[model samples]
Target: MSFNLSTLLMTIITSIIVIVIAIAGTRRLTTGVPKGMQNVLEWLVDFVYGIIGSTIGLKKGANFIFLALTLIMFIFVGNMLGLPMNFITVHDEPFSIFGIDIVTQQMINESEIIENGHKVVDVAWWKSPTADANVTLAMSVSIIILSQIFSIKYLGFKGYVKHYFEPHFLFFPLHIIEDFSKTLTLGFRLYGNIFAGEVLIGVILLMGMAGIVPLAIWQGFSIFVGFIQAYVFTILSMVYISQKISH
Candidate 1:
């Protein structure tokens, strides 16, 4: 299946909706005695804050908890949302939205066509939004940017520079390299895990429709792995922020 800009946009919109709903659902519950979904969410919040507070300080850790929660919830939900087998592939079609013209898909003589304002072509819907390299890299870049921003804001220019040359000046290049590696690892880790999970689902589909048996197994594992990856990403972000803010 082929994915288009519209589908990507829809996926992002839905992801935002999921995050907002999650936040609102758990926001007002009493903190002392969490229950139901609030219990699970509070546990996640406390766990993340605990890591940050232990590594950095209580105040900064509490401040960064919202950012951590946002990233974790968004990515986790986005990855799991891919498992639902509910979507369609059709030709790109031109349509109007809010009086503004846009192109998507349309039916053409029992076949799907993608309208390019002037013409349409058959397109297939194949994978989840997170499976796209662009989306993964964009997320990575965003996290990296946040790291820099936090560093600059908390550490100042001199302190930020000092971060790259820790221990001694002789080891500056190695330290710089090591610091940059986190960004690369963070991006690729999420991309690799999500993409591999997606590919496994595709393999199951190819085996046969009766492949429903294995689909459940793959999807279940996908959810678990997705949560792990999200946690890793959030924790790393907190770690980076703490490292920056510490010095």
Candidate 2:
């Protein structure tokens, strides 16, 4: 539901590092046949463009390609963060960074206790931000807001308002509810998938008692899940935008 402070902090830190690497790679671009980071970035850009073009049409989707790419990259990166790191809990009171305690200890279990009674319980340093409903909801709602703006721009204010009453004025309430439901589903779907994945990985890790084989298998699967979720979210956003903007 709410973000773990450590998770949020980790998300920000990871995002910054990704951005820096991207910038560094991009700045060194050369004209003749891309290599290394340039090759990877180009491929990613082309992949996103292909998705956008297929979903929203090449012409209209061009306007939104960058948004789609950014969303996929950010979400994928956030999801990937929880895969490698582990966290511990300090249970005497709560763990705090700079005088603020962010970890919700209630959500953690006794099984997570590694050593030294309740005074300190070690856990992972960060969780995937997409696992938190608040983060996903914010992302989905922002997309909805942007969709509305595009709808108005393309349809004019009167046309945008009339969209709610399509077929009959009686359908307006249903349409409103549909909009809310879209946001809810979009947000919760990502949160649910990622959160469930994290929890499953944790449980597996515990059961395996730090076994390499199980950890490797689950982490590999988790990476695949993360990429698929990112793609699904991006394509859905493009579809939503296209629906709103197209006549």
**Every candidate's lDDT:** 0.71, 0.82
Best by lDDT: 2
Error of 2 at 226 (Å): 0.5
| Per-residue lDDT of 170 in model 2 | 100
| TM-score per candidate, chains pooled | 0.76, 0.87
User: Model 1, range 16-115, lDDT digits (tens) per residue?
Assistant: 7667767766778885777677877777777877766766677767778778778887778777766876354443454455755433333233344334
Error of 2 at 30 (Å): 1.9
RMSD (Å) per prediction? 5.7, 3.2
Which candidate gets the maximum TM-score versus the true structure? 2
Q: Lowest-scoring 10 consecutive residues by lDDT in candidate 1?
A: 101-110
